[model samples]
Target: MKRIAVVGGGISGVTAAWQLARERAAGRAVEWVLYEAGARLGGTVETERRSGFVMECGPDSWVTEKPWARELAAELGLEDEVVASNDAIRRTYLLWGGRLVALPGAMRMMVPVDLEAIADSPLFSEDARRAYMQEPERAAELKATALPEGRDESVASFVRRHFGDEVTRTVAAPLLAGVFGGDVETLSVRAVMEPFVRLEQQYGSLILALRERATKVKGPKKSVFTTLKSGLGTFVEAMQREIPPQMVRLREPVEAIARIGGRWQLKSSRGAEEFDAVFVATPAHVTRRLLEPLDAEAAELVKLEASSAVVAALAFDAERARGMEIPEGFGYLVPPQTAGEDSLLACTFVNQKFGHRAPEGGVLLRAFFGNRAAGTLMAASDEEVISRAREQMALALGELPQPTHALVRRWPFSLPQYAVGHLDRMRALEERVARLPGLRLLGNAYYGVGLPGLMHEARKAAEEALG
Candidate 1:
């Protein structure tokens, strides 16, 4: 029999262990152990349920375009739980000048597929509108100036190259920050926004590419996001149930990892253990430390800056929620510069975004604190965090009623920032990792930060390690 070790019981690590479990049950002649430092699993993916309300503590849902998470849900016998977002009223608002303004319809991020929508929208100034209108004509120029085959640039530069400063600041920055929790000025265009980069290389103008894409891609439009009816926490629970309970070692942190005699050795609270293969799915910082003794150069390559986040989910009863006039759209994002000292990053109208989140007539609102704000607020009491979120949200959506149920969560250094040239660094890191036999690295620290990406990476790493 072969022994395998999986460190850090986040979604990625858990998924890897689950894959191994499946193989073991099918007579693969393998045994595995999952080590988690925390008391619970799921890392940032968690859900809270109370008073007929299902509030997501971390990620509410995965983007529908990525099938990995949805597929995994199906494999876990959660097929009926899969639900799509309510795209009929899928409008996202922006907090500008202390007022909520709806972004133009038929717009993908900063690029507007419907030029007429941009012209009629109040979100962008006349200068920004002109930039959108002129982008098609400048397609040839953009193509000529596109970065060479193997070069990378900041997301800010890529957005400015096409839509100029106003669009980058007013629209792009907030959208990116809401997802990646980092400054557009430092995030890599090639790594974080690869699809858009490819469009730039091919069509030069993102607007042109999106317009053509709209016409060519023929299908009943899918929802932008998808989730299980019970909540993402159910996904974690289902995965845990499938894997043998004895194989999971909760609260046992991996102190260090080393490559010895072409095998992997992991030292944890239970002392040292040897394995035929090891999968490290911890956060970037932790993984860097574990890799330091094995290969200092690889450690240097994995040293990427990460950002923190804070979430507050407030669930109001039917009567109290009805009294508050919430907007129809999904949620709103606060531009960093416009936010000033305020820590609010974004808020989600949970019921409107997806069904089954709140009971009939009830409401659930989730507030996200930005990276800088999260650092200062992480140490505060849950009441303080909830109060601050409620106060900030009330400013945009009028006086909010006292919530019937509320919860707060803090994730420090969770989102790793993929800086410019991140792809190049990851390429070198992959090469170094390959040199260490029976070792694999998996997590949000490389490739992507989305649920689907992590699932895909974890499954592939598990298969490779087994082979």
Candidate 2:
């Protein structure tokens, strides 16, 4: 049997192991061993049940449009367990000038093609609106050469150039902050939000591209995001169950890796193991530490930049929640420029948006904190964070009542920031890693920092390892 070792037990690592197992079962004689540094297998993907609330420590849902995660779930017999967002109450908010204002409808993140919605939104000032209207007439100039023959300009530069400063501050900054937990000024447009950037490049204008897109799709619009019926952790747990217990090692942190005698030798705190192939699925930082001796350049590239984040969950009585007057919708996102006293990047109305997230007459609210501009918030004590969250909840939802239960999860350097020129760095790393025949790296740092994107990398890594 060809011995293979999979390092890091996160979703990426577990999924890669499962895929490799399936391939091995199909006539390839392979022995697989999966190692997780942490006690639990699910890395950042975690779900905690406190009182009657289901609190998601990391990401809550995966983008369904990106099919890798969903496809993997189905292959694992979790198709019936899938759940979609509550479209009936699908709405988001923006914190503008110390106030939580409803984000305009038909506006996906920062791309605003709906003039009617933009005109009606209270989030923007008259001057901001006037400036936004002049976007179509703005002169188009190539800021930098495309990364891969046709892509160029960072997300910040793109928004500033096309939509003006108001749009970048009011719309783009918050969206990017929420998604990447990074500063908009440094994020790469092509690396992070390439789809919208591509649309603008193709059509010459965002508004024009959106209108053309709306005209092409002739059916009832579908919600863009989704999760599992039980929770996203269900998917992770299922994958864990599929892998053989003997082959899986939890609470085993890998200390280092080296190429020994044409085979990879993995050293963990417990002991050392040699394998014919190795897949490193930890975060870029952890991956860097493990690969430092094997490849210095690869390690350096993985240590580029990352952001800290904190997710707080607050539970309140449903009656008290209803009285708070939170508008009917999913949640809200606060643009960095306008965030004030009780400023938060985004708030998820868990109970209202997902069923069974809370018990009867109880509401669950999740608030996200920390980004490049708001890193101090990540270091604040839980009491301070909760107090600030309650203040914002009272102002935005009018629910000043004390929370029935509260939970906070802090992630320092949890999110990798894909800044300008990140794609070039990743491409160079990939080319370098390709030179090592049996070595592979898979994680949010390479492709995207979302569930689907991570799953995609896992599947690709598994296929490559098996081949």
Candidate 3:
């Protein structure tokens, strides 16, 4: 049997192994082993249950438009376990000038395609509204001219150019920052949000793209974003159920990986293993260290840069939360420009967004901190982090009630920021990897940082390795 080893037991690693196993079960005659540095299989993707509260350490749900994650869930017989968000409450908040304001309903992320929505929304100032109105007229001239080649611009630059500084700094920047957990000024608009940028290039107007998209009817619009009824951990548990117990080795960290005599050798603190093929699914930095001896240039590219973040889950009585006057929306995101005043980047109203996340009379709030310039915040003590979160919560939610429960989760080098020239860099890296036989790299850094993106990359890597 052909032996294959999958390193890093994260979503990407597990998915890759599972796909390979599926192919093997179809008479490929392949043997597989998965190694995880941590004791648990899911990396960053974790759900904790405490006092009837289901706290998600990483992502709360997956986007349906991506398709890969949802498809995988269905294939695993977990369709019944999936639950969608309350569409009636599909609202997000933005922090502007020390106030939590609802993002305009029709405003999709960085694109303010809905003029009437922006005008009617309370989120922007009169000046901001006037400035945003000029975008369509300004963009018209660019549409008439020849498009630039390899247009590489930051989210801040692109937003400010089309929609004014207020829109960029207050709304666009915060939304992107919350999603990427990185600085908007360094984030590549084309790389991070290609669909929106492409829509603007192709249709000349974001409003037009949205209108066209609205007409397309596919599947139940009800479950756009979904999670397991039990918790996100249910998905992880389901994946584990499909794999043999002996194939997965937890708490086994690989220190080095090198090619020896036409095969791959992986050295871990626990021991060493040999395999015909290998899949690297850890973070870029970790991958860099593991592959340093084998490929110096590949390791260097992997060490470019990544952002760190911390999530604080605070639980309080529902009565106290109601007394604090917290609004009905899911949560609010703070732009990087409002750095000092609002140390928090975003806050998720856990209880309101998902059912059974908190006790019947309890409220759960998850606050995210640290971006590019503020990554040092992740190193702070739990008490200090909680205090900072409370300070921001008080300003956004109006009042701060002492929490009955608080959990601090820190991620060092959590989200990788795809800056200018990122695609070119990835292309070069892919070409280099193609030269190495029976080896593949898969993770959030390549395609996207979302769950669906990771699964897509994993499945693609598995196909390449098996082929």
Candidate 4:
């Protein structure tokens, strides 16, 4: 039997192992093992509940548009447990001009799907709204324009060009920051927002393309996000259930995978072991260390990537929170210009988002801080992070009583920033690794950071490896 080793126990690593197991169960001649430096199986996907309040250490849910996550749930017998978001009260707020401005009812990642609604909405000035109305024609005119050769631009540049500076600063920046935890000015457009780029390239304008796509849809609208009733941790547990016992080694740190005797050898604290194949799903920074000994140049590219974040969850009595009169909304994102240097990135009304987040009469609030500026916030003491969160909440909502309890989860070097021309960089790294047979790269840093993207990439890597 061929023995394969999977490095990192996060969603991607676990999913890769699961796919390989499926191959083995089908009578394939292969055996696989998973290694994790940490004791936990979920990586950052942690959910803790106490006193009827649930706290998500990592992501709360996965978007249903990405089918890999949903399909995995059914494969694990968790489809029934997958609960959709409470659509009855769906709302999101954008913090602009020192106020929690409700986002237009129909908006997609700062794109105003409904121009008339946006024109009437207070999120943009009249002049800005007028500029937006003219974007389709302007973008059509600019369609003949081509991207500069061998280089990628930033999200800030794309948003400013298609929309305007006002939209970039006031709306897109904050919402994007919540996802990347890095500066949009440096993040890559091709890597981060490729779909938008494709829309522009294919139809000559994103606005027109969106309008055309909307007219062609034939089914009733479905919820975009879903999570297990017990929380996303349940999904992790479900996946873990499929993995064989003794195959997963918790707290076993893998130091490197180097070519030895035409086979890959894993060097770790537990000593060296050989495997027919290997998969890397850890953070890019850690991936760098492991790859350095094999290909110094390729490892350097991984070293260039970095990510970090902090999530603070505050629990409060529902009646007391209601007294503060915080408006009804899903959550709010703080624009960088308005948020200043020391503020948070975003806040989620966890209790309002999903009914099961809190007990029948309690409230749970989540404050997210990401990237370098927010990385400093992550490095701060837990009490200090919570204190900052409290101050931010006070500014957003009226003053309220102290939280009954709080939990702070730190994810160091967690979210990867796809820097300008990141796809090119990734391609170069893939070429280098391809020379090493049976070795594959799979992680959130490359294709996407969402749960579904990770699973999708994991499945692809496993299929390729097993074949």
Candidate 5:
């Protein structure tokens, strides 16, 4: 039998195993094993079930903009189990001056699409409003000049170049924290916000490009995010069910990987094993360590030091929540500059975003705090963590009572922040890895961090490794 070893139990590893499993199911004649260091599957994609509530300690959904995850779900017979966000009240707020202000309707992820929306927003000052409006002419004038191609810059510089410092501080910084848990000044423009940059380059103005996009849209659009009926854990469970039970070695952690005698060898707690091929889907730093002895050059680019993420979700009593002055939207984001040292990143109205996650009449909100600021809370006692969560929620959602239920999940070095030059590094790493035989590295540290991105990498790995 063709022996294959799958290292890491995260979504990427599981998806890659499942893809290879399909090939064996199609009469390829192969045996595969998945090694998970932890006792359970679904690394960070954990969902805790309680009395009538689904508490997600990690990601909640996949943005529908990327179709790979959904397509795979359909293939797994999970089409009927899919659920989208509650679009009717689907709105996001940004914390400004300690107030939860609705993100202007026309903006998408900090890129202002509507000058009128900026004009209507109380969050922006008069100078900001004027600078926001005049971006197109400035961009057009800049576009008239010759610029070098393929130059990379930070997300902060890109936003500030067109939108000004205020936009970067208030909109981009907060939104970047909410998503990547990284400072915008370090995150790469080419890796993260390439589409916006490309649009500007093509049309000479983002406003002009957005105007054309809006004009061409002839009908209503679908909600941008989707999840499963039983929470994200359900997706993990479904994948586990399809994988051969004996193939998954829970509590078996891989220690090192080596390429020896035209085969890949993995040293784990159980001992050493050889495989015709191996996929290391652990975190980038883990992957780096595993490959360092075998391929130092490749490891250099694959090494990504991830950031810390602390998620604490608290539920309010249904009756008590009814009369509270909680913001009536999807919650708000706190910019780093305003949040200061040891500040919370953002607060999410979990129940408001997806009504199914909570019990009837109850309110559930989650706070995402990251980096050194989040580290302080993560190292604290559960009581301290919950207390800080309460304080943050109160500051963002107005005065609120103690939680009827609270959960704190600390994930250290979980999110990989793609900084400037990340793309060039990854490209070089891919080229180097391609030269090696029967080895593949899969994880969010390279291209993307979302579910769609991970699934996309899995598909590519399957095609490249198996085919």
Candidate 6:
């Protein structure tokens, strides 16, 4: 029998192990063990249910365009549980000058497909609006100046080149911050914003590319995001059922891994074990530590900086919700310039964003603190976190009634910042890993951060390992 070891039990590790289990069931003569340092398997992908609210403690949903997560959900017999974000009234607000300003409709990130929508918007000043109008005319110039293939730049430079400084600061900063918990000045344009980069390469002007694509594509659009009806917790639960309980080693932290002759050796709390193949799926920092002794160059490649996040979820009952005024949009984002210590990086009006998240009359609000703010609050008590979140939300939206239930979750160094030239670094890392036989690295740290991308990578890693 072929023995394989999966270290760390985040979504990526779980997915890899689940695939191995399927291979075993199909008579592949394989046996595998999943080692998770934490007692729970899901890592940050957790959900809490109380008083009819399906509250997500971490990531709420996956982008719908990526089909890997949806495919996995279907395979797990959760097709019916899959739900789409409510896009009909889909609106996202930006906190500007102590007011909520709706992002213009028909936008792909900082690029606007409908120029008329932003022409008079308060979010952009007269000069910024003019920059939007002049982009298409400057398409030829932009195309001429587009970086050659394989070269990289920061997201700030890319957005500023097309939209000018004001739009990049006002619109792109908070928007990208909400998604990546990263600063545009440091994040890789080629790594994190690949689609926009491709658009730049092909059409020069992103606005033109989006506009032309909109005309060519003919179909009803899928919702921007997708999730399970009950909560993402259900997805994790279903995945756990596929793997035997005995095969999962919870609370068994892998101390180190070494190459032993033709096989791999994992030293954990239960002592050392040899495996035919091994998947290192821990966080970037942990993975770096484990690999340093075995392959220093590979370890250096995995040494990416990461950001933390804090989530405070407040659920208000129907009666209390009725007395408060909530906006119709999904939620709002706070730019760094306008944010203070107690300010939120972003907030999601859970009930409005998706159905089945809250009971008919109840309201579910989630406040997020990202990057440095999250680092500062990592040691804070739950009460301190909740109080600050509530105070910030009340300041942004309005006076809020007391919540029926509230909870706080802290994820330290969860989001890995894809620095400029990240792809080049990852390529070198992959080459170094390939030199070591029967080894694969799978996680958000290598490729993409979203669930769908991780799912695809995990499945592929399992196939390659067994093959």
Query: Which digits, one per residue and each the tens of the lDDT, describe model 5 over residues 1-467?
Result: 77888899999988888887788788877788999999998889989877667889899999988898899889989998788887888778877787778888867777667778888899888888877888777866756641246678899887877778998888888888888898899999888887887776777667777878878988887787898866888878888888888999999999988888898888998899999888889988788888888889988887676889999988876876787776666778887888866667888788878757888888888888897777787789888988887877777666778778889999888999898889899889889988778788887888889998897787677756766
User: What are the per-model numbers of colliding residue pairs?
Assistant: 0, 6, 0, 2, 0, 0
- 5 or 6, greater by lDDT: 6
Which is the better candidate, 4 or 6, if ranked by lDDT? Answer: 6
Alpha-carbon runs more than 4 Å astray in model 4:
146-151, 319-322
Whole-model lDDT per candidate: 0.91, 0.78, 0.79, 0.82, 0.83, 0.91
List the candidate 1 regions with Cα displacement exceeding 4 Å. none
Whole-model lDDT, candidate 3? 0.79
The residue-by-residue lDDT of candidate 2 on 276-341, one tens digit each, is: 999888888888888788878888888768888878888876665666655678888877776664
| Ranked candidates (TM-score, high to low) | 6, 1, 5, 4, 3, 2
Clashing pairs in 6: none
lDDT of 6 by residue, 315-385 (tens): 99898899778889899999877887667889999999999998889999999999777987899999899
lDDT of 2 at 353: 82
Position 136, candidate 6: lDDT: 97
* Weakest 10 consecutive residues of candidate 2 by summed lDDT: 139-148
TM-score against native, each model: 0.99, 0.92, 0.93, 0.95, 0.96, 0.99
Better of 1 and 5 by TM-score: 1
| lDDT, residue 263, model 6 | 87
Question: Candidate 6 lDDT (Cα, whole model)?
Answer: 0.91
The model with the greater lDDT, 3 or 5, is 5
User: How many clashing pairs does model 5 include?
Assistant: 0
By lDDT rank, best first, the candidates go: 6, 1, 5, 4, 3, 2
**TM-score-superior candidate, 4 or 5:** 5
- Lowest summed lDDT across 10 adjacent residues in model 1 is found at 335-344
User: Candidate 3 lDDT, tens digit per residue, 1-467?
Assistant: 88988999988998888888788778787888898989998888888888788889888898766778778889999888777777668788877778877888765675655688888887778998887776566657645541355767887787776667887877877887787776778888778878877776776656566667767856656645777767877777888877887999899888888898999998888778899999999998888887688888877777657888788888886666566666786888876776674378889987778777887878999998766424666667889878878887888776688887788888888889998778778888888787778888878777678988888888887777667
